[model samples]
Target: MEVKDNVVIITGASSGIGLATAKLFAKNKSKVVLVARSKEKLDKLAVTLPNSLAIVCDMTNPHQIKKMIKKVLSNFGKIDVLINNAGQGYNSLLEEIELPKLRHIFDLDFVGPILAMQEVIPQMRKQGQGAIVNLSSGTTRMYLPGMSPYSSIKTALNVASHTSRLELAEDNIRVSLVYPYMTATDFEKNTLKSPRLSQSASENKDFGDLPPVDSPEKVAKMILKAVKTGKPEVFANPYLEKGELQV
Candidate 1:
């Protein structure tokens, strides 16, 4: 899909991968709509990007999501791309994790993306072509002792993205997923601090040395390449490789 002149909405755009992608899109001349819970940061970022609109939204809230979509359509007239990047993680064993927190992670990592897709599908169908890019963790391919909740939800998201790709094929709407290998984002810090995670994480603190990770800006470039080349997914890492994949 062409990035230029496209109406793109990126959730979690206040920072990290979302923010990096927003900057790239804006530079490419796409009408970028930045969504996040931080109004101050979004407003500040929007000022630097041409044709950018910032919508402060909690992806977990249905009402706020609907309003965000309405606002985007009212401003841009059409939605060409929806990037589902707003998500949080919990660092605890499944048995040790609280039930409510697990559900909340599911709501943000799984449900919110699907809800946003639901809202945009009608418009995409009317347009006859569009794209949905979902951010999923590369950790799903491996394993982590204290990352069951996060990895499981991301696994589910990867499946949903694949299925959506098949279901939306005839409509010319592409569904793509980005599996980011341990990027140097605030994810680890936030996950460790998450209240839903067990206190054991804070007490024991066996985090060890941080692994070398990709920068958000580099991953953002990979994502844009995936969208522009009609690639179904991106395995973003230092290697920065691509392949035709379906699962």
Candidate 2:
């Protein structure tokens, strides 16, 4: 989809990959709507980008999402693309993971994106064309031992993207999934983990053995390119020797 002169909504746009993507879109002259819990960061970013609006929204809250969509439509009149990039990590054994943490992760990783899609699709259908880029994880295919909880939720999102893509095709609303290999973002530092678990191994592994973590800027560019090209899926920093994903 052509981004110039279009309205693009990016969740988790306060920092990391979302922020990078928002900047790229803004550079292309897209009217950008930045959504995240950090009002200060959003406000700061809004000033830096031309034609950008920062909205403080907690994706887990349906009411906030409703107000967010209402506000976006009120300001921009239409949404051309929705980037579901609001998610976090939980690195711990299933047994060590608390029930509350599990529920929170599920809500943030899966339920929230589903609700955003529900609210945006109608507008897209009316417009007769739109694009949705959901951020899933590369770990979904790798299946790391301690990251099952986090990866599983993202897997559900991938499935939803696939189904939504097929269902929304008649309306010309394209849904794409982005699997970003470990990116050098603050995501891990912000992740929920137990105090009891030893962090040494995980911390060392993060900086060393795992596939080279792509920069947020790099991933952001790939995602935007995929949206422009109308690709259904994009995998960043693939682990395979061929380093090319079939999709």
C-alpha TM-score for every candidate: 0.90, 0.94
Residue 153 lDDT (model 2): 92
lDDT for model 2 comes to: 0.89
- Regions of candidate 2 where Cα sits further than 4 Å from its true position: 206-210, 240-247
Clashes of 2: 0
In model 2, the worst 10-residue window by lDDT is: 238-247
Q: State the lDDT of candidate 1 residue by residue for 102-153, as single tens digits.
A: 8888888999999999999999999999999999887687676678888889
Best by TM-score: 2
Model 2: per-residue Cα lDDT over 1-247, one tens digit each: 9999999999999999999999999999999999999999999999999999999999989999999999999999999999999999987887798888888989999999999999999999999999999999887776566887898899899899999999999999999988888788899888888665546445655445656668999889878987897788887765622343333
